[model samples]
Target: MSTAAANEADAGGHELRDLVTGLGRAFGGALVFSLPMLMTMEMWELGFAMERWRLLLLLASSLPMLMFLSHYSGFEATWGWKDDLRDVAIAYGIALLSSTILLFVLGVIGPGMRAPELVGKIVIHAIPAALGALLGRSQFGQSDEEEEEEREQSYGSELGIMAAGSLYLGLNVAPTEEMILIAFRMTDWQSLALIALSLLLMHGFVFASEFKGSEATPDTPWWSAFLRFTTVGYAIALAISCYVLWTFGRFDGLSFSTALGVLVVLGFPAAIGAAAARLIL
Candidate 1:
């Protein structure tokens, strides 16, 4: 072969190898982030008992978010809309396959089960796994190139990252009865206090600390970061909490106040997750 032909062949080989490596990391991330929910009894029960339409809506909503995540921090660096879409598909595929294999191995799924039950279980669990897959490059080990890309993201993209992070953490715990139970036990005063605490913690994580990915510089005004990132991030967290609760039917029979309380309770962790996303991703 000519010199140019040899170079072209080497480039093709490297691209193929990178694709395989990226897929492997995506699979590892899917399992690592989703293992807890996969083992939860509540998640298993919610799979079959929740409304099919709600499950479908959840799955549908996850796609756009996954695509955005791929653009921001997929298992490999994406170059264009097509690359983002491809990564989204690959991540979702990895999520579904991994969830199916793990559930089957644990006897959580089997041939005896009906199709809806089996499919619902895998689909619900796959949401977070897919997010993890898309986030694998950033969370596991981001390259310098990817880091520069992330830093140049617009303010809107920053909010999108916050929402994704909130959803990931909220989904992990929303299927559990504890969210409702804690909400039930808390008084109005306690809920107010918890909301305040969540904001404080969220602000501390991103702006107040000297962490590696802290969004604020020493010269940056505290109040500016607080209003722009912290407050908005908390709001995103609360919204995601409400959506996750609604999806899981947690708000089905509650009174208005009780439902609000549940949102507050879940928002605490969601807020922290949102703040942490800025640091990590």
Candidate 2:
């Protein structure tokens, strides 16, 4: 081969190696994120028993969500939209494979299991597992520049991150009856207090109650940041909570006031997730 051809071959080989490494990382991430659900009897039952339409819809929605996650933080650093699409595909594939291996080892699957049953089980669990793969690099990778950039992120960028984080974390809790139950017990005054608490906690973690590496950027006025980041972050969290509740059929029989209370209840954790997103994501 000519020297140029040999160099081309070398570059291709390096790219192949990187891709393999990235997939390996994604597999590990999928394990960490999916293990809990894989082991949970409730999750397994949901996988097997969930309505066909809901399951299919959830599976279909995961691709776009994964693509969005890949845009912000993925196992591989993407160069373009095509690259992000590719990474999202690979992340889901890794999720399927990792979930299968773990479930099989856990005795959740046996040789005699039917094809549709096996597929449903793996596919359902892989949703969050794949997302975990998409977010794994950001949580695990060590880069001072990335951390510094996150610390000093613009208000708009922080709002975007908060939205993503709120949605991501809210999904985990939204399907449960506990949100509605908690809402049922709380009075109107209590709901109002919860909202106020969510905003204050978001403010403290993101701007005040200083922890190392959690300080604000210079020239960021206190009240402006409070209004923009804290208030907006809580709003995003509350919105995500309501949307997830609706998507999961949790709002099917609820009255408006009851639904508002549920939103407030779930918004608490969603807000915390949003506040910690900058540090974590």
Against the true structure, whose TM-score is highest? Answer: 1
Residue range 1-281, candidate 2, lDDT tens digits: 99999999999998898677667778777777677678777567666766667878877866766776787677766657898988888888888888898889999988998877788888878887898888877766734644443333455655666776786678667756678889999999998898898888888886543422333554678787687778888888988787667656677888998888888899999998888876676
In model 2, residue pairs whose N, Cα or C atoms come closer than 3 Å (at least 3 residues apart or on different chains), thus clashing, are none
> For model 2, how big is the CA root-mean-square deviation?
3.9
Q: Name the weakest run of 10 consecutive residues (lDDT summed) in model 2.
A: 207-216
Off by over 4 Å in 1: 144-151, 208-216
User: Backbone clashes per model, in order?
Assistant: 0, 0
- Each model's lDDT: 0.87, 0.76
Please give the distance, in angstroms, between residue 38's alpha carbon in candidate 1 and its true position after superposition. Answer: 0.4
**Candidate 1, 63-176: lDDT as tens digits:** 899988888778988778899998898898999999999999999999889999999899989988999888888767865665676646677887898898899899989888
TM-score, structure 1 vs. true: 0.94
Q: What is the TM-score of each candidate against the true structure?
A: 0.94, 0.80
Error of 2 at 87 (Å): 0.4
Top lDDT hit:
1
